[model samples]
Target: MKELERIIHDDSNGLDYILVGEVYLPLLAVPNETREIGFYGSLHRNYLKDYKSGLYSYLSLSGKLWSYLADVNEQCVERRDYLMDQMMEQEGITEELKSRDQMEWVRRANNVRSRVDEIILNEMVYV
Candidate 1:
């Protein structure tokens, strides 16, 4: 979270990077306006997902944002595959479809994709 804040606030990156990262979704249903929502939940996911989602949602802003999002997505894919591979090796599971753990991974991955897509699509733009 601190890293994200730093990246968003850092003046060295110029307005585009700072603006994209600084934008966030607020919790509309909450009684207190101060409550905020983000691309990722702090209680569960690491900051990478939040960071990636931020970049993804802001793709319309500039080509630079799109490229950054792509890079983040690529890194996420590699990380996901590496985690699955490590799990399979440790469990000695050769068959992806047959392994319950692998299937769980697939299910979770799909759910996350859908969720992030929804989050991005429903993002609020402030003037």
Candidate 2:
């Protein structure tokens, strides 16, 4: 446990043990305890800056929801590029279908980009 603490403290891996110790573990200790929610809320209120910083760091560490969003964003970009290429090709294709497909791809790409930007903005504001 001491070694774990030392590692958690020293590692730049961005683990927030304070959240773990103050909020998560206590909740885990008594899964059915209603008081755990209040304890977590109190911890968040008392250590707002630290809690936000920890949350931002955890999100930026590239494994949780942020990572998944990033991966999906990349995929969206790739698909958009492919669609653009297809639309640009001189092969015989209906103008209507091509325009529709291009619009759809652009819309999907923009949506993913917007979501990723929102996540980043949220993290920045919280931190």
Tens-digit lDDT string for candidate 2 (5-38): 3222325643334334434321111122222223
Instruction: Give per-model TM-scores.
Output: 0.31, 0.27
What is the total number of backbone clashes in candidate 1?
Answer: 0
Clashes of 2: 0
Cα error, candidate 1, residue 84 (Å): 0.6
Model 2's alpha-carbon lDDT is 0.42
- Across 48-114, the per-residue lDDT of candidate 1 in tens digits comes to 3455566444443433443443444454445555655665566555555447577765665555555
Give the alpha-carbon lDDT of every model. Answer: 0.42, 0.42
Backbone clashes per model, in order?
A: 0, 0
Question: Which whole-number lDDT from 0 to 100 does residue 43 have in model 2?
Answer: 34
RMSD of each: 17.2, 15.8
Best by TM-score: 1
